[model samples]
Target: MADSVTADPAAPSATRPTGDPLLVLSGVNKHFGSLHVLRDIDLTVHRGEVVVVIGPSGSGKSTLCRTINRLETIDSGTITIDGEPIPAEGRALARLRADVGMVFQSFNLFAHKTVLENVTLGQVKAKKVKPAQARTTAMELLERVGVANQAEKYPAQLSGGQQQRVAIARALAMKPKALLFDEPTSALDPEMINEVLDVMVGLARDGMTMVVVTHEMGFARRAAQRVVFMDAGQVVEEADPETFFTAPRSERARDFLSKILTH
Candidate 1:
């Protein structure tokens, strides 16, 4: 079945705590020399939840997403995934990264590798899966993302949407417990945005816990269970998608929605 927003958008759905949170952050802070990029951030992502983070440029939305996987380190605060504290480095960090998959705005595929190779490379190298096993898994993921037909093509040969879908497939091949999308559709042409979004929609429907950083309001409304609004390096407000769009409590959130939704 296609992924869908819960019926009755106004109905509240509390953050599910079926067990321990799959991802958690508390008092997270990050600074770039004199610039404070993230300020006292706290977030919890439960299993099977889809949370979309949205805000103006320089609002720290992307930085927030990066910290979850330790792509960017926090100066303070603790982050834990599946009840384990984030490791500082070495094999522990590598294992943590394997459990969390990240897709960047850039497709970041090896220019020389075929789409199939791009998906299988990490599985074979990092996870130490056998080549034949990795190939079968790669083909299954490519089919899942709707790009099995283009498996033999290089990144340069595919459209931006197709390349991003391959990127998603590559991340999924790792069999991560959660996925993070950093503006996955920002680089795509308008016509291609929906194609990438559709693949993401499918992943959400299949119960992949996801945190997406994007300006795609329609996807945010339709797929996200919770909408987080950030401003000036702080989480200004967070609410269910319907309430966030229709009845934002903070003036900053209201102004942001006005500027984006009107245009």
Candidate 2:
């Protein structure tokens, strides 16, 4: 199930100095029986780049993010990460997942474990990091996310913003090369969204390679180097923030922006 589809035969390996791209999706198609969730998805993300994806519901935004980690299988086409083609299952897939950290809308934390323990588990299990070393790393990441004070608290005891920060720290503890956020702020209350966004803004400031699927136009404008607009399982437009927001070229993109910004 490992395959690659490069834009050019002489193209360099994705994620290499050959300038191929950090990630590439070519003619990527996903189907659940007859329902096509993604169609002919062609995209390239380079190192140290942030790309924001936006689309209407069912436009395959979340599905596309999940596909990067093989959380969902593609029925056709290929996806490459750092020049490595994603395998269907087993050790190679596990390694790929480890290299790519994902943050979900729901703060997927262990409610029963302390925040420190939640962050430590993955490092200990997946990375085989020593307990003491893992704890030190976890604390540093927690501090980075501005949640070091909440390390002893359980998810149930923390506010939504705090919980999400902890989740971000946990993801960073894995030292992933790239982070995928599937609507990271979608589940937060209006007042709490900024806190999470602030942490993400800091990450962007540090030049983390990130792909965020969010409708937060403000964050997209402020943080993303490229904004990709998808419609009907296809990318209708791709542009910088200023161009995408002020002068989108596609009719669907303009319409989508009008509706979202109006409200």
Candidate 3:
């Protein structure tokens, strides 16, 4: 919901600052037919920490992000958010999703709804907030995202970047505990990419806990407190941004960096 969610709607369940595990994945595994997309994944994302996951395409980074919210279920392993394992199904799972906001590679906005309605719908429908209150919050978010002027327009009428911003505003309307991004900028035109990345950077700076899967090294290097490198469906390296970018300890990481940096 942050265009500049400088003002949080609610505090973390507990302020871990840099240690409390807001999201934990243990021995997480998944498969798509014969393809093992995730393999014994174990990771922890602390409260208010931003972790960026980077890897070549088909490395299962996107699948890993999807598993957090149960959009893609795992064959084995455990994932917990805010100290609670994700609900198996029904209203409980829905409620858990409300707590974990997600932004996708494609701007998954309601194409039929106006930008304002798109942003406010989740708050009113899922959370049962009054329409007026939801609208006020929606407008505030849209304004902060720099798309308030286009609030009345349909998704088709706005540029790709604007639609994505509206999608972010919609996610923020829920005031989730953590946000997951699955290559959010991959679909945008080159010129429109930064507008969305800038919004993400602002969210990180404002203490939003986020787990991002992206190929944008600059964004990862600049915003992430830790960088995770995934390869062949496994986490091969995890390090601070500087260590990852400059003195990578893993040969796999160094090769990956060489390939990425040579471009």
Candidate 1 has which clashing residue pairs, if any? none
Where is model 3 poorest over a 10-residue stretch in terms of lDDT? 1-10
Pairs that collide in candidate 2 are: none
Tens-place lDDT per residue, model 2, 176-256, is: 988999999999999999999999988988878889999998898788887788887887777777777897777788888
The digit string of per-residue lDDT tens for model 1 on 1-263 reads: 12112223234453433334789989999999999999888888889889999989999999999999898999999999999999997888998898999999998988999999999999998999999999999999999888999999999999999999999999999999999999999999999999999999988888899999998988987788888888888888777788888888777888888998785
Cα error, candidate 3, residue 178 (Å): 0.4
Give the least accurate 10-residue stretch of model 1, judged by summed lDDT. Answer: 1-10
lDDT (CA) per prediction: 0.88, 0.85, 0.87
**Model 3 TM-score on a 0 to 1 scale:** 0.92
User: Which candidate do you rate higher for lDDT, 1 or 2?
Assistant: 1
Runs in model 3 with CA error above 4 Å?
1-19
Backbone clash count, each prediction separately: 0, 0, 1
Superposition error at 77 for model 2 (Å): 0.9
State which candidate, 2 or 3, has the greater TM-score: 3
Model 3 per-residue lDDT tens digits across residues 2-36 = 11111121334211247588999999999999999
Q: Candidate 2 lDDT (Cα, whole model)? A: 0.85
Give candidate 1 misplaced runs (Cα > 4 Å). Answer: 1-19
Model 3: clashing residue pairs?
Answer: 1-172
